[model samples]
Target: MTRASLVVVNYNTASDLRACLASAREKLGDAEVVVVDNGSTDGSVEMVREEFPWAPVFFFGKKGKV
Candidate 1:
């Protein structure tokens, strides 16, 4: 069987990220969702870690998409 994955590359867009993830959870059932945070200082990392613990989050520590 084939597996689906969703990678969300974000930078200082915590609010939007929440909405996107929520929608993905509702629409994309059983899909693996990952978040790549580009060193956001707006508490995005914490929010993801706390709210979306199921999703794996990676910190790039830079201002570019990886």
Candidate 2:
């Protein structure tokens, strides 16, 4: 079950990102999903990590990077 890589960037959009992730999971379950959280204060990173633990999440700081 090998599929292409999927990269999604999120910025304080928790609910919408979840929906997109759900759709991607359904359509491309075999693919690897990577979610890059750009300095979120609404707990987007936590939500993604807890709910979609299978996916790898990269979190950037307030400057959107280290």
Candidate 3:
């Protein structure tokens, strides 16, 4: 079977990310989701972890610097 991957970069925008993830889940369905969090201080990472637990998360310290 073929596999798909989705990479989402999050930067303190939890609402946007949530909406995006919802759409992605609806569309992709079986694809793997990868979330790269750029040191979000607004608890975006935590929300992603709780809401989208099936998706893989990668943490990168600080945004614009990486």
Best by TM-score: 1
Could you give candidate 2's per-residue lDDT for residues 1-66 as a string of tens digits? 666999999899999999999999999978999998889888999998999998899998765564
Q: What is the C-alpha RMSD of each candidate to the true structure, in Å?
A: 1.6, 1.5, 1.4
Q: Which parts of model 1 are misplaced by more than 4 Å?
A: none
Report, for every candidate in turn, its global Cα lDDT versus the true structure.
0.91, 0.89, 0.88
Q: Determine which window of 10 residues in candidate 2 has minimal summed lDDT.
A: 57-66
Cα distance off (Å), candidate 1, residue 19:
0.3
Instruction: Show model 2 residue runs off by greater than 4 Å.
Output: 64-66
Task: Give the per-residue lDDT of model 1 (tens digit) for 1-66.
Answer: 328899999999999999999998899887999999999999998999999898889998878756
